[model samples]
Target: MKKYKYPSVLTIAGFDGSGGAGIQADIKTTSALGCFSTSVLTALPVQNTRGVRKIYPIPIEAVADQIRAILEDIVPDAIKIGMVHTPQLVETIVSTLSGYKKIPVVFDPVMVATSGHRLIEEETIKAITEKLFPIADVITPNMDEAAILADMKVVSLDDLYTAGKKIKQLGCKNILLKGGHQETPIITSLFYDEDGHYHSFESSKLNTNNTHGSGCTLSSAIAAYIAQGKTLYDAVSLGQQYIYQAIENGMDVQTGSGNGPLNHFFNPQKLIKNEMV
Candidate 1:
């Protein structure tokens, strides 16, 4: 018998008390995908399925220290970032990641909660757009977040294309415009690459309230698969399917009074740990 240590994936995001979204979902998705997951907390969210009650962001220096300390010991194959609630935090991450040139970054433009509450500050949007977007390998933005960043209402496929173009111009290598919030029977996710190519992935939309943490899960899944050597398109494609199955499987489970969490552990992977026999 032999043993091995799996490669690690890092998630920099906020903390959710309900364990539905943010870093919690990222960690869950990474672990379930057979990658060891590490995390740096960006914000402390007082929230449940009902909604976000309060948000307290970590100090910029502290955030930097956390990432620096983690990077020193483990160079993650890929990293997923979410919920940079302030301009300063966004700036700090940009500076820190810039120093480490090799890691692949998956940025989830997490701006709102599942219950329709804003998570990031209004003043920080510009910093994220100008600073982080340029550095990210991939940026995942849902309909609402895409609309906010693009400064327009994304109500249809036409609006989605416009939004994707607008975000692509911000310098992200790839933009995944998620269409979960649209009121339609089929969900269409749009991906625009740096080479001026567009891809649309469509799936049957599930009618359920357990859609919380889906964006985080999908982005983290992409990062996880990428860490294991999958191409960007293949990673995102499989990530979307993973998310769709998680949502479908969790549709029947009751987790809370409001929107429930996704089934992140739906298809678990066994880890081959390093050991001496």
Candidate 2:
């Protein structure tokens, strides 16, 4: 008998029944990118494309057990973390992921929702900065989140670089500062690596509201590419391209009453397989 395995990515994220964001988005993105996905729910956010109403964060012990349960048996090739709501949750995740130092971790600091709702608790910021940042291979923060992390207003391209440097100084290996919130037709994202180098990626901002899960999709895409053995630079680059295409393809579709979701399956790939080593 022959055994086979598919590159797997574990998504530690919140739940969005709307299927536009959170764990749903992560799973869809990873699956579409040709990687198997496992998940650990960190929160239950009552949300839709319209907005977020309430968030119930899972207890730390429960989150820990969930992480251990899957991680112990089906170790993933990469991890994508999202929507950590409490300081204790951050500690729990950091401690567990610290054991798997070799796997690349993509941390998307999901502080606020697209509908102007705050997701994480206040104290979690300090814990995330001190404990979680060190373990993450890449941290992707939108402009608003970057401003909070950098402790200043991130208003321009220069602010992206400055804030990215400040974020890296907090022990993150690399930072991708997303500039989507800027009022420009061309959105630019800056990638600052550990070596103090900056790479910029730009995409024409599509005039559409069908971008509910874009962030989760991008971060998961990066992790999926990494799980498939792409270099960090290449993973980030490809992730951007994938997300832009998803958004472009989904622009006209309507899922809910408000902001819709990206078309994650616009170009789905067959799940890649390899013989178990």
- Candidate 1 per-residue lDDT, tens place, 1-277, comes to 5765676899999998899998999999999998999999998989999999988768888999999998998788899999898888998988987777579899998898889898878999989988888778899999899999889999987899999988887778899899988778987999998798999999988999999999999999999999888999999999999999999999999999999999998889975353434
Candidate maximizing TM-score? 2
The candidate that wins on lDDT is: 2
TM-score of 2: 0.97
Candidate 1 error regions (>4 Å): 1-3, 272-277
State TM-scores per candidate. Answer: 0.95, 0.97
lDDT of 2 by residue, 1-277 (tens): 8899999999999999999999999999999999999999999989998999888778888988998888898899999999987888898998877665467899999998988787877898999988878888999999989999999999888888888888888898899898888778888999998898999999887898888978899999999999999999999999999999999999989888999999999999999997887
Q: Which residue pairs clash within candidate 2?
A: none
Kindly report which residue stretches of model 2 are placed more than 4 angstroms away from their true locations once superposed. Answer: none
